[model samples]
Target: MKKKLWLTILVLLMGGVNLCHGQSLNTTAAEVADFDVQSATSNMQDLKSNLDEVVSQLYSLDEKERGTDNAISDKYRATRKEIVNVIQTINQTTDTIGEQLKKITTYKKLMLLTYKDIQASRSGMVDTKQYIEDFSNFIYKLDNKLYNENTNTIDDLKLMINSDNIPLTLANDSLVQSMILQLNDLMNNFQQNEETQLETIKKLNDLKTRTKDTIEQYQTEIEKLQQKKNYLLQFMKLYQNDTRQRQLTINNFFESTKGVYDRTVELVKDIKKWVYKVDFDMERKITALNELENDNEAYPLAWPLYPIEQIQTYFGDINFQTEYGVPHVGIQIKAGQWTPVYAARDGIVYFVADNDEIGINRAMIVHTDGYVTIYQYLKKTVIKPGDTVRRGQIIWYSWWEPGTRGAGFISKGANLTFEIFKDGIAMDPFEILDASIVKDKEALPDGYQIKYLRDKYARPIDITNLELMTGTTLAKRENQFLIKYGVGVYKQVAFREDAVKDTNIDKDMVICIAFAESTLGRYLSTNANIGNVGNNDRWDRVPFTSAYGWARAIPVTLNNAYLWAYHTINQLSRYGNKDGNIYASSPINWQTNVLKCLSQIKGYYIPEDFPFRTGPNPNINNPTPETITFGETLTQ
Candidate 1:
């Protein structure tokens, strides 16, 4: 009966804990939703204000033009000047509207980023809540077990003390007193355990409450952004419509003014036909401005770094447009942290640190003829505004810490965001930048395109840059092949790095030959004979002390034995048939397998070896060249 009662209490406590978590989760979700609504409203208010300013300018222009029409007949000469003034005002207002639209677009992107932050925060909260729930459950189960056990022990001791029908001697009396003390101790321990559990639960509940409060603040921000976004959308629609109508009005006035101004010029010219005709230099400033604009195209910019590991993001990416409501304005070069950032062209520093509010540390260089290059997410800067820098000069260092304010949330690791702008409008950096330094660009065959063998091999698959690639990335790629094929010789060995460091042979050729020789050492004898050198008996094998020992020996063995026999796989296959200088029993088969593995290891995917499987799984004790033929090869 006592156990049944305790079980009922346990069930009630479990239900209470669950109820508390459920209520807290629901409240958090609601707050996040509310934040979105408020954010949208705020955006709308800003848009509405900008729209009003544009509309007012349009209205004032319309009134001015209308007034000029009213006095045209009575004061035709005086109205000519007024018409010129109205035309100039219209041009200025049009520029103003364009600037306003750019601001609205920027705000839209900010709101989208806010939404991403809210989602990340909510995910973190869910994880924290789950931890608290599990912790509470463990504590509750322990508490229930202790309570039941202690209660039964106390009841049994009481029954023992009450048992009678014997003399009350000193020994019996002392024994009863001892039983009473034991009961008291058990009760004290039970009470202490219960208190400890309560304290633990209390601490856990406090942690949960603190977590919720922090997220609540974030949710509040989200709500404001959501409301602003909604409000902005409404105003954007109104602004678009208003601007369209105003544009038409301004266009009509422009044409009207042009015709009137032409007639007025002709009338005045006849009246003062012989007046002093001094050639004015009115176009001097305009000519200078035009020259500056054209200069941007004449001189192309340089790449900030050579052999870039990857392009993280490109200009005008569709994904960027969907997330930010505007196309990306720059290219993000994936580079290592602290890598030097160079100036794209010869230019004066315009801004050493712009867009800091978004946590982007950047530098802008104003190049010749109105061209500007922006480098963002830099760790350190060495130049200040107004300092002139040459093309390819070091300007800053790259940043790559993820979750840091410096790198922002979207960009994960070390990268440089490079942008080119001509007269304040963003241009594609790839389109305008010079490509002389990127040798990999010209390495691909006419019809062939670059592709990754796997996402893990993050670098570009350019044979030219293969040796120049980072050693760690190269080693990781080589290790994958070794691990997958269960190659005993090259497993956990830096074969690629060592081969490149020790020999002049192609990295791909070395790895391919190893695969063709022994499935990358999987079938090698315990001696770790990678190349099967000096094993002329076909089934024979040479030995090395260790995998690294074999790695060091293969490059030397290849250079001495094979370099004279063949420089290329094609030549080697044809010559392999020669009696004494032969490298394989079936030259054609050897060539086919080597080339197949060669292409795969060089950033292309291929299926497993078929037909006669020489891999470790089939348990081939020894895989000879004659036994591993792809098929009956054609006689050449």
Candidate 2:
């Protein structure tokens, strides 16, 4: 029994040794399969990386090639045509290669080496398909990018050639040449990388270079053409004798070239902006140019009068005084009585009347130049309402009468009043008139001739208060001489008349008053207590001390005159003696009454001291009375 048991133990141990050797063989097989799978994965990765690098380099070369002269010239165009013709061939080759790659059975071998991992085979097939599609998409993108960029570059070049004022410079030509060279380099590089012939690319580059060189030569010739054009312009300017012809040529040049020049500048600006990725639109610039070209024209000046006769009165100072104690502010012409009055220029007749209430019937014409001509003291108007008249065309007839007021009143002789205005303001008519036709006849009246009468006796009229007396009431003072020889009343009448007539009292009446009052010599008071007569003190006391020949009486008398029958009947009212009660007791009463009467007549308002005089003490409140006398009428 012991011998049998020992034999069984030996058999069991031998069986265990065999089992250990089988297990070692299985582990060694697993390690070998794992190493093979790792080697295959690394190989596939390296191939894909190599393919990606090639595609990247090809894409860069294509981009550079597109800007070459070959791309834009006949060779480039022909090459493109060839490429297009062989597109199907290239595509077929690509497809065959793809199919072959797909059928590479290396995946199965790698799977076997990895043992029974079914998922590894499926993963390998997916990776291969993905790589194929990525390469295909990359090639397609490169072709499209090159084709579009080349096409666009050609179009841009064409546009540049057609634009106006394109400068032909070495720098510009050099750009085209450089692009051609770059394109040639790109083609060579592309061939080397892809192992393909760029025969079409080379031909296209040659053709483009030739075309660009020809264009540059033509641009250089254009410099000579421009010089010739400038010479012709200079010749025309020098030899052209006819002013009208010369003017027309200048106008035409400006009108024709201005639009083109401006447009060219704008176009170049937009092209630069586009190159730099700036936002711009060409349509707007084109529209603006068209508008400018259409509206370019010259404005011509209009002559005031055609065949202008001698200017009867040039604009400037005239020898005439107004009833308002002011000198004539504008020019006056002396046309013969009953002479035909014509329009100065083509314009609308703004006014026409048989009477302006200041004695002259006037017709005023307003021209487009903002100038107006007034033909005064007209007997009759030929033109009616809204009548348009041409220069030098008769519109009315001049009428002159003795003892008329303002512009029509002529102390020297019978004459018509003519006046001119610019922009509603009076200007010297002589400046605009034809000097040859209107010979400078007489010098203007001197400043001394415009002196006022009241300037000698009392003082200057208070301009600020003249409007107030129009509505004030009055009371009559009790004095016999004040009622009769109270020159105050008559003097007031003259003052009011002078104010209304628009004449300077200083020029028209001051000198006369001085002669009449003190024989133009200084007067001294007989009583020392009264102060000097010609000085300020005597004049101050005269109002309260005497009812007649008083300095204060001057303004009071002038105010009373406006309320009297003299002014109220002959001047203010169309009907004689419209109001009967006309006397006033004081200057204040006279102002109040005159104001009330004037207000009733025309709703006119008078200033606070309408009839008051301007002086060192114009507004003194002393309860004084004064008087003044009327002198003979004086002419400016």
What TM-score would each prediction reach against the true structure?
0.26, 0.21
lDDT tens per residue, model 2, 463-491: 32333222222212112212322232232
Model 1 stretches astray by more than 4 angstroms: 1-299, 354-358, 435-636
Global fold similarity of model 2 (TM-score): 0.21
RMSD (CA, Å), candidate 1 to true, equals 24.1
Global Cα RMSD, each model? 24.1, 50.0
* Residues 336-451, model 1: lDDT tens digits: 75566777666666555532322356666666545667777776677876565655456776765432334433344567878777755678776665332333444422321232
For model 1, what is the error of residue 235's alpha carbon versus the real structure, in angstroms, after optimal superposition? Answer: 30
lDDT against the true structure, per candidate, is 0.46, 0.34
Clashes of 1: 27
Once model 1 is optimally superposed onto the true structure by TM-score, how far is the C-alpha of residue 213 displaced, in angstroms? Answer: 41
Best by lDDT: 1
